[model samples]
Target: MSHFTKCELKMTNLTALKRALEDMELDYTEAQANQSVQVRGWRGQTLDASMCINMGKYDIGVVSAGDGTYDLTADWWGVETTKGISEAEFKDRLSQRYAYHNVLQACEGKGYTVEEERNEEDGSIQLVVRKWVSD
Candidate 1:
């Protein structure tokens, strides 16, 4: 049996989330407010999802689990997309972009400027920011 797992996000900014998706070059659809999606689970069970990302043969769903939290709903059993990316890979990529977007915003809010940005060969990102400290 399969069911939607709660991811528990601290923040719920659809705009930021979409921006992360765009940064990752992943195609997604912004569903109408309160719209629900049907996600296929491991056991071929259908679950409710609120967001959909086009992953060729199989798509992943970002579902709202309430309290400003979202869940990644999908079938882990025998799931294969054209990209041949696993669920963990997809989530990691998305989280990285998401963190990047949030960190940039946070640093700017704290009067910090981005000094350098580097993309690691291992698909990781490195960002350096500087802020003027009053003496």
Candidate 2:
């Protein structure tokens, strides 16, 4: 009996998500059949996921809950593979990269140029963008 935990994300951008994952050098596969993953659970806990990220012995899944959002799902017991990565850490890194790419894309779309970019000591990214307005 295994249980998959679900962490709901703020938005759904499969393309951006994939790019973010690649930027982090994580191995993943994009779902094309629009199918969902079914898994068992402890105490009747179940999960239906839309996408999956290969993590060797285990996998992290993303479930689309409609309304422009998604949820990250994975079994807690199988989270750590030979790589010794945790589910929370994986989600955190993914979310960070996702946010980075999301902001980057938004800035580029609004005619803004990235002036400075750096990783802070707090494990967060700092970006400086600028857009000049002609009068």
Candidate 3:
């Protein structure tokens, strides 16, 4: 007989996510519960597991496991990909590389205008903003 336990993992809370983002330094604006925000990837980069996890706060279907090792498929925000880092380490690196200050600078450099800022139901502050690209 084979036994398997179906464990349901809860989604990370907004406050936790906000703190993680703060640690990483990624700039983000929050939307209402029913609103969807368009996530802009850094130039020349595509969405990966780390970014997905950071953005969505859940483990997406994409993951790699080998020899008792687990790695996220995405780069840690502005940090390049490297081995020998644990999941927690990776999260920390993401925060350092993509810190809010850095992200805000990048956005301003890109000419994006700040739209709005507000506090979430979780008592966390969120920025609602966007930028327009000239063709």
Candidate 4:
């Protein structure tokens, strides 16, 4: 029997988060206003979350940490067995994707355009943003 666990992702941007989740091809429910989704846990356990990342026989959840950040909650053992992703690996993947989308969106909001997008040899991504200026 697996027990539920929670990890802080320190995520704040919802729009970027949505894109990140989608980019990973994950099935999830967005944060619903005034309502929380019930995330199924191990052995009939459950938790209510603002957003849900559904995995077969288990689920990961995003919840506000009461300090302007969000946490990722899950039955880590179950998820590892079902999805083959360890907790650290899951966090790293999601964090990387989230940062990628977040940076693009921030640059766009600041009137900058992406000039080059490149994936490096070290499993890292590089992005260049340029702003057009008129004298």
Q: Quantify all predictions' global Cα lDDT against the true fold.
A: 0.70, 0.74, 0.41, 0.89
Q: Each model's TM-score? A: 0.71, 0.79, 0.28, 0.95
Misplaced by over 4 Å in model 1 are 1-11, 37-46, 78-81, 121-123, 132-135
lDDT of 4 by residue, 14-44 (tens): 7888899899999998665788898888888
**Model 3: per-residue lDDT, tens digit, 6-67?**
11222223444456556655555554455433332345334322223333332211122424
After best superposition, candidate 4 residue 62: deviation in angstroms?
A: 0.1
Model 3, residue pairs in steric clash: 23-95, 24-95, 24-96, 24-99, 25-98, 25-99, 25-100, 26-98, 26-99, 29-127
Give lDDT tens digits, candidate 1, residues 76-109.
Answer: 3334435677767767777877888988888888
lDDT of 1: 0.70
Q: What is the full ranking by lDDT, best candidate first?
A: 4, 2, 1, 3
Query: For residues 1-135, what per-residue lDDT tens digits would candidate 2 score against the true structure?
Result: 456777655557887898898998877765558666643334545566666776656667777877778777777567664458776777788889998999988899999999999999999999999999999
Question: Regarding TM-score, does 1 or 4 come out ahead?
Answer: 4
Score candidate 3 by lDDT.
0.41
Error of 2 at 39 (Å): 7.8
Against the hidden true structure, what lDDT does model 4 obtain? Answer: 0.89
- For model 1, give the RMSD to the true fold: 3.6
Stronger candidate by lDDT (1 vs 2): 2
